[model samples]
Target: MRARTLLTWANGTTLAGLAIARATGATIRPGRDGVLIAEGYTRRIPKNTCFTVGSVIFTRRTAEWLLADERTDLFGHESRHVGQYAALGPLFWPAYYLFCGYSYAMTGSYGCRNALEKHAGLHAGGYDPDHPLRPWAARFRRRRSENG
Candidate 1:
């Protein structure tokens, strides 16, 4: 449709084909609202985890997407990622992984501290938007305290 949308699909196909293929048995279709949706991926991926490749959103359950009112915001959240793909082009994957690593190192959680995830609005993706970033060592201390 739009040039940006085209770029999104191109980047996604080139960079994330394995992920797309992993979503086998999922119903793949174009959304009326300019998104690509692939659902029914539970056989391949964990339930409740949705991954986006460009404009394509892959999920385990189409019913949850269709029925849940809160899911409407998820589309907006994912759309921002699609925009990121369009902007970053081939560099997106590497950059994304770098962000994930940084986030993990800083917060002991990837999404909570990831710049891209934060830009996309973590709350929209069912994550805490204002989560405090704890040092990695803090995780071990908390666990040790719990055990002790």
Candidate 2:
């Protein structure tokens, strides 16, 4: 079997086991360009959010695909996530959320300090590292500046 197919299988298996993909009534299919896309979950995931498990992409909106006829910046960004899943296996999701929480605490943005997001090019994924600070973060920053 092709390497890509094997990779997709591995991702799909892990995601299915975790119930991250293949949620009830979800649509699963291979894209024209060979990417595996899954959608239609009843979960309240944010719109336009797309997450990858191994080589399979779980998305709320099918039109949110980063890849198509050619790879865009978002494609390159998400491709890093696929590599991350391949490397981390079932641990990827938990580790990812941990990083997300850390990033949120540090920078008031989920992707700002996330290592994976940084490696994947945060701006490439439409994220701003210097996004406006959260209320608490803003106050902290203001206090630090005043003290300095």
TM-score of model 1 (CA atoms): 0.75
Task: Kindly report which residue stretches of model 1 are placed more than 4 angstroms away from their true locations once superposed.
Answer: 12-23, 43-48, 63-68, 135-148
Q: What's the CA RMSD for each of the models? A: 6.5, 4.6
Quote the lDDT for 100 in model 1: 78
Best by lDDT: 1
Which tens-of-lDDT digit does each residue in 1-148 have in candidate 2?
2454456456564355235564455577664334566655456654436666666666565644434544476666766676666667667778889998988887777887888888878887778967776788779989999999
lDDT of each: 0.69, 0.65
Best by TM-score: 1
For model 1, state the Cα shift of residue 53 in Å.
0.5
